[model samples]
Target chain A: MDREALFQQIKKKNSYLCIGLDTDLEKIPQHLRSTADPIFEFNKQIIDATHEYCVAYKPNIAFYEALGPKGWESLQKTMDYIPKGLFTIADAKRGDIGNTSALYARTFFEYFNFDSVTVAPYMGEDSVKPFLYKDKWVILLAHTSNPGSSDFQLIESVVTGRKLYEEVLLKSQRWATPDQLMYVVGATQAEKMESIRAQAPEHFFLVPGIGAQGGDLKMVSQYGMNAQCGLLVNSARAIIYASNGQDFAQRARQEAVNVRDEMARHLQDYYK
Target chain B: MDREALFQQIKKKNSYLCIGLDTDLEKIPQHLRSTADPIFEFNKQIIDATHEYCVAYKPNIAFYEALGPKGWESLQKTMDYIPKGLFTIADAKRGDIGNTSALYARTFFEYFNFDSVTVAPYMGEDSVKPFLYKDKWVILLAHTSNPGSSDFQLIESVVTGRKLYEEVLLKSQRWATPDQLMYVVGATQAEKMESIRAQAPEHFFLVPGIGAQGGDLKMVSQYGMNAQCGLLVNSARAIIYASNGQDFAQRARQEAVNVRDEMARHLQDYYK
Candidate 1:
């Protein structure tokens, strides 16, 4: 999806919420375990119950990948099942050399047909450039939510005097515009978001680490929002795994509604 | 495979040559295109022809992943087909959060039974630690071969005065021992290999960019090799796509023999 289309979805839904389908077989409802493809079945119900409450679905690829060929089948089925209008993010942190990365771009953007795929910036320009198609988005990892993110990303560059993540934000801008590129600025780094916002004023930030990771949505929305409501706040475990009983889908919808309602209030206040 | 076992393989074969199975439908011979699983068929023939000349098989995951579920099936078949003693490297270059990384580790290690998987160090310790299992290896990207490697990796850190890749090498060592840890020190960055060898003397270095990418084998061997012959120099297109006809597998075998011969000479000179 393009920048304006995504913005319109946020305006229409009154929520910048992106539900993460980090579905694991071990964590799903006991009844669904009997199904032929429990992962896809679980994702289908989650989408049905909560599609209206969010504008995007981010499926963490590892969960599907762990299941082997069947997992790939489940992921393909889930991709086919998600509602067309909702922006889909393949939370597959993939990046490689030029030729290999082009194949990955084809994998996610063409084969699986995700609207966007998250990419790691450790490999640099050529690795990321292949994913920058006209409508498809490259959500580059800038400042990640994990504690290990501080390892290299926070290191100060002698030449630029910018921290590594800041350099990522600054240098990657040269590769792609705000239209095709977005930053994965973790919600846990709320204080850093203000400075990050200043660095990439127009680019949308896919904000992970909200619910399960204990990131405050209000603080993230307040500091990270732009005129176009440039933030896609992701909630994974806290929403999807709200209940492991038969009421899992219903409980997930309730959790989604609670988050969406809060996002709606934030849209009115911070999304100018 | 463990460090001593891998070194023993090098001693037994007199080759540290790693052939990369970057099998693409468009690039393989036309005859194989008619097969039920062309990718797997092509890989099987290539492995049949070249297995003895190379100690390791690095299947670039992007090629398999591009074909979706069927592609994954081909990968599993190829993994199953590879002879037991030969080392296997999943050139996936995948790393995420702790939980996600664990799933990826499981996907490559348990599900597919790869000896090692390449990991990008952008997310840091927790992202890499999960892959450092007993006998399984985490081949971290150090100085990559691409032109863009100069972009972020070469950036000097103000605090440490070391390059970003240097910091990665130093910090990642604290996460895993040489037994379970390796580094993807691209052969294109041969000039930097000496210092890299100094920083990571014991750990194995899975070097790419040798044949098709024009990295000099002698220079890479001179600077990168250690007591255990700590270099698995990879050549994907140069060996695999040597021909596109019925002579393809034979040509691939010839290329593998050429690389293996050179690697044997280097092993005699450099394996201390």
Candidate 2:
């Protein structure tokens, strides 16, 4: 999906919410387990109930991969089921050397049909440059929401007195415009959002760390949202696993409604 | 495998060669294309011919993933077929937030039974620490073999006047011991290998770019190689895709033998 289309969805829905389909076998409703594929069944119901409240859905690939070949089949089913126009993200943090990266690009963009895939930037421009095919987005990791993110991303670069993420934001502009590229700015670091936006104002920020990670939605929106409403605030367990019983899908819809209502207010209050 | 087991494999084989199984359906010999699973068939033949010459097999995950679900099945078959004691690496550069990363660790290490999986360090310590479970190894990306390695890795850090890769090597040492952790030092940057070894003396280095990428065996061995012959020199295209004709597996065996012979000499010359 293009930037204009994505922003249009955000406005039309009045929410920049991206529900994370981080479904696990042990975490799903027990009644669904006897079905042909429980993971797909769970996701199908959750997407059906909550798709209207969110602008996108991100299926964390690791969750599917843990199930082996059958898991990938379930993932394909879920991807196929999600309604079009709701942007899809393969939340797989994949990046490799140039030649190998092309196969990954094909796996997600061509085979899986995701609109974007999160990528690690430690290997630099060549590793990430392959994902910049026409229209498909490359969401580069800047300052992630994890504690380990400080391990390398927070280090200040001597070449330029900027932190590694600042350099990533500043240097990666040469690769693509805001239309083709985005950045993963963990919502936990909302204070840093102002500074992060200062570095790359136009680029969309796929912000995780909101619900389970203790990040305040208001603060993140206050600091990060742009004129285009450049934020994809993701909530996984807080939305999808809101309940584990037969009412799991109903409870999930309720949670998504509450979160999207808050998000919609933020879009109206902050986005110009 | 543990550190002693890996070192023993190198000593027993007299080769630190890691054969990269970047199997492609279109690239395999025409005769094998008619098989039910040509990729696995090609890998079975290659492993049969060259397992004696190499200590490890690194299957570039992107190759199989490009084919969708069946590709993963072929990968599971190839993984199951490799003879015991030969180290297996899921050449899937995968890492994510803490919980998500745990799933990736389970996917490659527990589910697929790979000895180790390469991880990108952009996300930091927590992203890497989970992969250190049991005896499974975390081959951290230190200095890659691509031109883009210079983009972020070679950038000098202002915090302590160190390069980005240096901080990665130094900080990551605190996360796991040498038994569980390894580093990826690209063969293309042989000059930097000496400094890299200084930061990480005991840890094994997974060196790629040896044959096809024009990295010299002699130069990489000179700067790398600890007392344990601490290097797994990988040659992908130069060994696996040595020929595209009917004698493909035979030619691949010859290529592996040639690379492993040179690697064996390096081990002999450096080790006490």
Candidate 3:
């Protein structure tokens, strides 16, 4: 999906929600485990129930990877099931050298057909450059939601007198435009959003650390919003794992709708 | 494999060579393409031919992943077939937030049973901590071999006056001991290895960019090697793609022997 189509989805849906399918076998409903393919069945229902309320779906690749070949199969099925008009983010934080990274770009972009794949910036330009195709995105990891994010990201750079994450934002732009590149800034660190927005105002920010992760959405939108509504606030566990019963899908939709309503208000207030 | 076990393998084989099984379908022998599983077949032959010479086998995950589910199956079979006592490194440069990272650790370690998996440190302590397990290693990307390594890694940090990669080496050490950790300092940048060794001399360095990428082995060993022969210099294309005919395995074995012979001299000079 291109910048305009994604922005249009947000305008039409009145939500900048990106629902994460961090589906785990053990975490899915007990009743569904008896089904032929429980993981895919779970995701299928979740997409069917909640696709209307969100503009994107982010599937955390690790959840599928842990199950081996079968897990990949489940992921493929889930990818095949998600409705069009909803952007897909393969929350697979992959990066490597030039030749190797090109293969990864092929995996997510061509093999799996995700709109974008999250990439780690630690490997620098060549590793990430392969993931930037027309309308496809390379959502680079910035200041992440996890506490471990503080390990290297907060270190101040001597040359620029900026934090490592800030340097990441400033230097990485040389590789791709705002349209092809985005950053994964944690919603938990919403206070930093204003400054991060200042660094790359046009690029969309894929914000995790919401709901179950305890990020305040209003604060995130208040600081992070741009003219194009440059934010994709992701909610995974809180929405997908809302219920373990057969009512799981319905509960997930309810959760998404509730979040969507809040996001819709933010979109209206900011844009109007 | 544990540190001592790895050391023993190095001594027993008279080599610290880590053969990169970046087996691409198109790159494999054309005759093997007629086989049901060409990638795995190519890898099996290469492993059989070269296992005695090299202490480790690093499968670049992107190569396998590009082929989709069948590619993963080939990887599983290849993993199952690698002889015991030889170390396995999943060169999947994967990192994510805490919970998601845990799933990735499970994917490479538990599901695939790799001795270690390469991790990118962009997300910080928690993202990488999950990959360190009993006898399993977390090989972090330090000064990479790529020209792009100069991109973010060489940037000087304001607080410490150390480059970003230097900070990564210092700060990341607190998360895991030398036993559970290794750093990938590229062979092409052998000049920097002297100071890199000064940072954490006790930990092993997984050096790539040797053969096809044009990294000098002697210089890398001279600067990087410690008392324990702390280097696993990798050569992927030059060895594996040495021949594309019926004699491919023989040529691969010959290439491994040549690299192994050089590594033996380094081990003797460094340790003795």
TM-score of each: 0.98, 0.97, 0.97
Question: Which candidate order results from sorting by DockQ in descending order?
Answer: 1, 2, 3
Native-contact fraction for each model? 0.86, 0.93, 0.90
**Residue clash pairs of candidate 3:** A157-B158, A158-B157, A158-B158
Residue A100 C-alpha lDDT in model 2: 90
Stretches of model 3 off by over 4 angstroms after superposition: A188-191, A212-215, B188-190, B212-215
lDDT of 1 by residue, B1-272 (tens): 78899899989999888999999999999999999999999999999999998999999999999998899999999999999999999999897978899999999999999999999999999789888788899999988978999889988999999999999999999999999889998766455888899999998999888763233788898998888889898888989999999999999999988888878887778644
Off by over 4 Å in 2: A212-215, B212-215
DockQ scores of the candidates: 0.87, 0.85, 0.82
Q: Using DockQ as the measure, which candidate wins?
A: 1
For candidate 1, the per-residue lDDT at B242 reads 96
Encode model 2's per-residue lDDT on A33-146: one tens digit a residue. 999999999999999999999999999999998998899999999999999999999998897968899999999999999999999888888878899988899999988877
Off-target runs (Cα >4 Å) in candidate 1 are: A212-215, B212-215
| Chain A TM-score compared with the true chain A, each model in order | 0.97, 0.97, 0.97
lDDT of 3 by residue, A1-272 (tens): 99999999999999999999999889999998999999999999999999999999999898888888888899999989998778999988897868888899888998889999999988788878889888899999987877777778888877678888888899899889988999998876555878899999899999987773234898899999999999999988899999999899999999999988888888889988
Candidate 1: give its CA RMSD in angstroms: 1.5
